[model samples]
Target: MRLLIIAPEQIPVPPPVGGSVENCIYQIAKQIKGNHEVTIVSLYRKHLPRTTRVGRATIIRVDGGSKSNYLRNAIKQVKGNRYDLIQIDNRPSFIRAMKQAFPNTPISVFMHSMTFVSKPVTTPSKAALDLGRANLIIGNSQSLKRTLGSKFPAQKHKVKYVHLGVDLKKFHPSGKSGAKPFHILFAGRLIPRKGIPVLLKAVQIARRSVPSIRLSIAGGTGKPAYKAYLRQTAKSLGIPVTFTGGLSRRQMPVFYRTGSCFVCPSQKHEAFGLVNVEAMASGLPVIASKIGGIPEVVQHGRNGYLVGAYHRPEAFASQIVKLAKQPELTKRLARQARIDAVQRFSWTQTASKLTRIYEGHLNRRQG
Candidate 1:
């Protein structure tokens, strides 16, 4: 099969910065190359090689002036290519352009998260309707499917849940068993929606119980003002929190391995917590809020603790304290989490499942 993948311009392929969607595409392309011809259409800010090969797939970088122009140029590029199957990552703005460009081709839209809900309520419903055109819609979690199912009932049959995969080889348990500071790590965009302030408040409470606990935050500030507010809150609370702005994918394993527990306290309806899976694969027990698809990833007492989404600093702090006090339980849960992650969330398995979806679409088109 000849496959053409269209990805957003905000992140590059084999992204220098960390991105789950880009990483997933890179992995799937590499795995499918032995059997299928894969071509990736990526965005370029400045001048780049128009055509090149990354791993096994051919990469085509297109110059897009703005989001609108990018999608237009992408449509133009695909119009000239010969592809049996077309796969596009979630970006609502490109829906109309994609439908117009490849009206006859079997197209599949893979949703990392629904972008339409992020917009204003007054906006027109074209984006939601355009999504219905795809032969298949792949969502990263069951919650995402339910959300889409409610929003676009006509296209419910097209929507299917296929969770993203983590690289087990890259993320695994560190054998270091020495007495270390109770290091807690948080990795994600420092945005208000991510609920970083809630984590900071919980850290303040945790410090009262476990004075030696250390919190390290890794990720760039998607909103600079929010990051500043978090810093001020931490200062006022006298919480010992270190914000490590933006670590690359290579640097993430070090933070994961060193930390006793990984925390993701998002307040929004997260489609799937990719960072949660990454932490599990790293053999680190997670402490997350009981919201969105977080429950699907973190089993309450089996892998780690899940606190209420409401502002319960004491409750959140107690979970951290409990983990700190019981090192054996923490270690056992982390080990089991690692095993579960490796067994269930490998890119090989994800790609194989995706291949079946593509084959199904191809078969339907042929018949």
Candidate 2:
């Protein structure tokens, strides 16, 4: 099948900087390349190539001044391309325009996250109407589907859940456990929503029980003020924090392997926690918030523990202390995490699921 995937203007398909949606698309594209003709259309940035091929998939960039203009130009650029299915990522408002552009074609809108990311100008009813036009709507998690279902009951039947996949080979056990001087790892954007400050507080509290514990942060800060605040807080608490800034995809696995445990203390409502799975894949016992779709991945007492988010650093601290104190429990959870990650989350499985969805949509359209 010929497939056209439309990504948000903020990032590219291959994603120069780390992005969940882009990485998801890249993986799906790579996995389905042998069987399908895949093309990713993204907003043009001066730094990115106009057109390039990654394996069997072709990435094309379109020039425009604004977000609206970018979408318009992207649609214009792909006007003549023949595609069996068109899959767009998390943009309900644009569904109507895209439908008008290709009236006969089957289009599927793949929702990667929550509605906050899209921020569509249209009303709820209008957005639902736009979504109704699409042949299918894919959600990354059941939490996303439930929320989207409540928001747009008219299109609820269209919603389907497909858990995001992780690269099993790249992220696996480091073959060494209970390393000396236990380290806690946090990797994500250094923003308020990521709960970086909360992690610092948790580290401070955990250190009383586990004095040898150290915190290592690996993520780029979009806001300098927040970064400053985090550094100041860490220094004030005398907590040893190492900020490695942003890391590329190639460096992520090694970073995760170096840490004894992974913490994702997000304050915001996460549609899904990709980092939690990645950490689990690396054989690290994950300590994430018990909110949103996180529970779907982190099974408490089985693979990892889920604590409360926000200002409750003590909850996180308790978990960290527990893992540090109990070496046998930590090793058990880490082993289970790796086994679960490999069994449940694989790009090959994701691609196969997506392929079946694509075929079903195409068949329905043809019929």
Report, for every candidate in turn, its global Cα lDDT versus the true structure. 0.82, 0.86
The number of clashing residue pairs in model 2 is 0
- Writing each residue's lDDT as its tens digit, candidate 2 over 176-273 gives 74458889999998888888888999999999998999999999977888888899999999999999989988999999999889999999778888
Tell how far residue 218 is off in model 1, in angstroms: 0.6
lDDT of 1 by residue, 145-188 (tens): 89888888888888888877888888888988978889999999
- Candidate 2, residue 358: Cα displacement in angstroms equals 2.1
Best by lDDT: 2
What lDDT score is found at residue 298 in candidate 2? Answer: 94
Regions of candidate 1 where Cα sits further than 4 Å from its true position: 45-48, 121-124
Off by over 4 Å in 2: 45-48, 116-126, 308-311
